[model samples]
Target chain A: AQSVTQPDIHITVSEGASLELRCNYSYGATPYLFWYVQSPGQGLQLLLKYFSGDTLVQGIKGFEAEFKRSQSSFNLRKPSVHWSDAAEYFCAVGHFNKFYFGSGTKLNVKP
Target chain B: DTAVSQTPKYLVTQMGNDKSIKCEQNLGHDTMYWYKQDSKKFLKIMFSYNNKELIINETVPNRFSPKSPDKAHLNLHINSLELGDSAVYFCASSQRTSGSIGEQFFGPGTRLTVL
Candidate 1:
């Protein structure tokens, strides 16, 4: 079955420090990758997505992800983490209209 | 205004009870979807409708029934709710006709708790 994997279950980063979340997928063809963030008591919001064309895509909230086809990975990164960035991040892969999401990684930003 | 909205933000029911959650979107998109987020915050696609036509149906139990009266509305009805059914349900819409990267707009989820 096609699935997305997030190696780290929980990650803690200090405020103003750099942050990176790992994401990998298993798919047969070129996959459409997406990154979403879910804050406490809030709905999931789209951070960025990679479909085709460029390998690197920038999204809202100063976040970006690079789609590496050879490694089958699309990792998210931020130069400086904010306290509000503490949320559950999900990596999803799909083609056309179908989607498969990773279990998710919870990021905790400590001062 | 909220583009996509769901009713009954929180629901509590007993086992074997039947309930329904309603979702509506004003995005004017061609496709709508239903997703379930478990306790672990893992979001999984359950069903999807494009212009009132069923498009994607994942591995969900038969007890869960989805109804779409119009392109703007998609509702989920569950019969004989089980403990496993307890989770947060989200409704999303997307422009399926878009050329390449189809972006989805999601609504505030409906959290269901079974006692």
Candidate 2:
């Protein structure tokens, strides 16, 4: 079956540190990839997406994700991490209108 | 403007109770979806309706039914809610059938707690 995998269950980074979250997918066909962030008591906010064209995609909140077809990965990165960046991040693969989300990684910020 | 909205941000009911979560999208999308976020925060597609036609019905139980009265609205009704059903229900909409891979917009979600 098609699926998305987020390797890190919990990631901790100090303020001002650089961050990278890994995401790998398995599907029969090329899928539309997306990264979403969720704050406490809020909805899922799209961080970035990779539909086609250039593999590197930029998104809001200073986030970016690179799509690597060979590796079947779309990892998210942020140059500088802020305290507010401490939230749960989800990687999803879209097939048609339906989506499959990963287990999610909870980022904790250390002061 | 809010693209997708869901009513009853929080719902708490007994295991045998029945409840409904309403979703509305102002994005004028032809496709609406219902998703379940489990305790592990794994979001899974429960149902998808495109132009009022059922496009995808996941392995979800029949106790949970999705109704799309129109393109902009899709509601989820759960019968005999169980403790396993105690998770966040999200409403999302996208332009799936428009021959484009438009990213889906999600609602704030309705967290249902079955006691």
Candidate 3:
């Protein structure tokens, strides 16, 4: 079965530090990969997505993700973490019209 | 303007009661979906409608029924709601085509509490 995995359940990062969230997926073909963020009392927002061409895709809020086919990974990265960046992040893989989401990772930023 | 919107931001109801949550999208997307976020915060897709046609239905119970009145509206109705049904339900929309795939736009979720 196709699934997405976010190994870390919770992560804490100091303000202004670099941040990386890992995601791995299992699928037969090259899949449409995406990263979504959900803040407190808010809906999920699309951060970035990878379709066909470039491995590295830049998204809103200064977030980026790279899709590595070899490892079946699409990891999200940010250069400097902001206090407002503390939220829940979910990685999803899209096949046809359905999306398989990973158990989200919660980020806590220390001021 | 909100791209996707769901009515009743918060709902508190008793068990064995029937309730419905309405969702609408103004993004002109053809596909609309309903997802359930459990206490563990794991989001699982429940149902999806494409152009008023049921396309994807997960292993959800028969008590859960979805209605699509039009291309822009999708409603979820739950029968005999159980305590386990207390969770946040989200509605999302996307534009799917042969040439390009669109990112889903989510609505401010409706937090349902079955007491």
The model with the greatest DockQ is 2
lDDT of 1 by residue, B31-78 (tens): 889999999888889999988999888889999999999999999999
Better of 1 and 3 by TM-score: 3
Off by over 4 Å in 2: B97-100
**Chain A TM-scores, all candidates?**
0.97, 0.97, 0.98
Give per-residue CA lDDT, model 3, range B1-115, as digits (tens).
9899999999999999999999999999999999999989999999999989999999999999999999999999999999999999999999997833568889999999999
Model 3, C-alpha of A84: deviation from truth (Å): 0.3
Q: What is the DockQ of each candidate?
A: 0.60, 0.73, 0.66
Q: Give the distance in Å from residue A73's predicted Cα in candidate 2 to where it truly belongs.
A: 1.1
Ranking of candidates on DockQ, top first? 2, 3, 1
In the range A6-51, model 3's lDDT, one tens digit per residue, is: 9999999999999999999999988999999999888999999988
Off by over 4 Å in 1: B98-101
Q: What value does DockQ give for candidate 2?
A: 0.73
Residue B112 displacement (Å), model 1: 0.2
Tell me the TM-score for chain B of model 3.
0.96
Predicted complex 2: CAPRI docking category: medium
Rank all candidate structures by their lDDT, best first, as comma-separated numbers. Answer: 3, 2, 1
True contacts kept of 3: 0.60
